[model samples]
Target: MWVQLRRSARTHVASVKGVAWTLFLFTYTDYKTIFFPVTAFACVAAPVQSYTRLLHGVIWIWLNLLQCNSSNQYKSAEEDALNRPWRPLPSGRISRSQASKLRWSLVPICIGFSACYGWDVVLANAFLTLTTIMYDELGFAGHWLGKNFCNIFGYVTFEIGATKIIGTSTALDYTAMISILYSALVIFTTIQTQDFPDVIGDSALGRVTIPIKYPEASRKFTFVAMIAWSVFFSSTWALGTLSSLIFCVLGAYVGSRIYLLRTVQDDKRSYVIYNVWLLIAHLLPAQTRWNVLPF
Candidate 1:
């Protein structure tokens, strides 16, 4: 029984990370700047509370996604057949009904906690909910809409939501704007990097994505352009600081990943390394000077 329980817990954690990384990577900036507001909203005053809130937010985000129709399709049987069964939806570890019941149970807690911070924060959460619903249920992430509007929404919502909840009166400054811009560039790279893994699955589903739209010849240029922009934005955002140096190094690391994607034909390793390297690139700057938690 103990072993079974341990196995179950491990499976859930993998499922959580699978779904969790998207929100986590995109919101790293928020983790740094809005740490206080996030903690307050979660009613956590200490380090422990902050960690709890961080976990809670990720779980809440995942729950919100699971409650949406897109989560089911994305984590559908087809994907499970291709991958592993440890995922909550595909593995039969948790039924759709069970997941829905659990997610529904958290809605009140999510809303109430956001409201505790401020009405604006609550509104921000609403924005997040709507955006995610559209991204998943409407298939925005797999299409052009995700590249345009959804990209903006992810960056803007995190900043606005956390700041409003915290009641921070700080006006948007050059530094903050730079941070947002750098973060947005990173988000776009994430979207592109994510496409390599989904190429087979998305192609099977006839989903439009960067990989689907661009031919092989054109992909390398696009990959290079993304890496260049990453470097440009990071330099602009963290100029003259130790953060800038770290960002430059991380950008090089990400550039190598892009090169691999261009040259490598091995689907499985390329996809997995694309994801792993992306995480490393994002984590580097956050760990260096920012010490920001990724969502």
Candidate 2:
């Protein structure tokens, strides 16, 4: 009986790992790691206060991940079967009913948590959740523009909630506005590359992503956008708004890498590069606060 119990524990652990991979928890965790710190640093403006808020931010991030990824998986199960057969839903590691139940369960928990922060946080969370529902149920993912818009909306909502939690401010200030704009630009221009890995699945589902809609142009566009982003960050560094030379160097390196891979059609590489670029971008704001390079 002890041996059987140990085997059962191992099986449960393996199943959890499979679900985590299916939900892209690593990517979401990376996003929160970069975003929440920056938001807390920017709003709280003190290390002690920022650290305090960080705990709440972590919970918010996990709730967001659960709400977004699970719903996405439940909605995109059919397409995922073609594009990502290894995912929990597609691989039969989890049932659709289970995923649906998980998603619905997370919704109230997220809203309640946000309510603890403030009405602003609650409102932002509600909006973000609504947008996620629209993106999945209304087939907004069918168009590249719609998909990008959804992403931007989600990120903005996240920032709003974070800002409200940290600063108790619901109004968009200069920093918040700039962050939103930068994130929107990133979502609009570079997020398309993420679809590269799932082209087959997306195509099978008749989804119109940039890689599918403009196969050749997509690479060129992404390359150019990376260059443009690099220049923007470098210029900000020059202007003293961006605090670190490392981010400038990192941006240049990522841009150059993407440029070199402009001709490569590997979705995995594109996905990896895109994630790297995003992490760098998210880290820039935090660097402005914590790791300013003296000129």
Candidate 3:
């Protein structure tokens, strides 16, 4: 009986680990794009929340991410196969039909998760769901302008919902709203930086991304935005001279790479650096909340 019990425990442990590994593989790529940013904004905006509340917020974001990624990956399997072959559907971790089922099933799960927070979060999730539909099904992602519009609003919902969860309030205060809008504006301008590295795959598919639409202009504009936004955010956030200098340096590094390198691999590296800057930008709100740094 003792041996049987130990064997059962080991089997259960192995099963748990298997599940965890599967989830990790499905969602790891989005850690930079979604999970980390949402968590950062939440923690920065509401630093005093309980661990349990934060964990619940994490679960909420995870549910929405599962829905978002599964849906987008289901539809973009061909693109992923070309540009990001290791993704679940492209790599055969799941079939297209299976992914479709998982995608649709997550919708209600996300809604239920949001209901715990209130109708406010539910509305936020609903807007994101609508944005996903527009981007994935309505052909919004096929055009550069439509893509940015969807992305701007989609990420804004994420910021708002996450802030509400960790802040333990259905209604965001005025400052939180302003900060989230600032983040949204940041995303609207630079989110297309993600498209630069996908030029080849996008070209193969005849997709029109900002990078593909105006190759020369896109890189130059990104360079300008990086420098301009860095100065704007640092000044508006009232970051100290040293802190602002560090922010500008990161911006300069990313901007220069995007403008100068003009290669797939270089753009990939620059995109990662851009996400780092964006993540730090998300934390700037904490400077408003608490004296995170001194001049």
Best candidate, lDDT-wise?
3
- What clash pairs does model 1 have? none
Predicted structure 1: lDDT: 0.50
Candidate 3, run of 10 with poorest lDDT: 18-27
- In the range 1-295, model 2's lDDT, one tens digit per residue, is 9999999999999988876675664235335433444444335332224567767775686677678878888898898777667666778877899889988898999998998877878898999999888899888878988898897788777766766565535565665567666766777777776776677778888889888899877877777787678678656534353444555555555555554554435556656655666655654554345555444
Task: Estimate TM-scores for all models.
Answer: 0.61, 0.79, 0.94
Compared with the true structure, all predictions reach lDDT values of 0.50, 0.68, 0.86
- Candidate 3: C-alpha lDDT: 0.86
Give the true-structure RMSD of model 2.
4.2
Clashing pairs in 2: none
Q: At residue 229, give the lDDT of candidate 1.
A: 57
State the TM-score for model 3.
0.94
TM-score of 1: 0.61
Tens-digit per-residue lDDT, 25-45, candidate 3: 678777898899889888887
* Candidate whose TM-score is highest: 3
lDDT of 2: 0.68
Model 3, runs deviating above 4 Å: 1-19
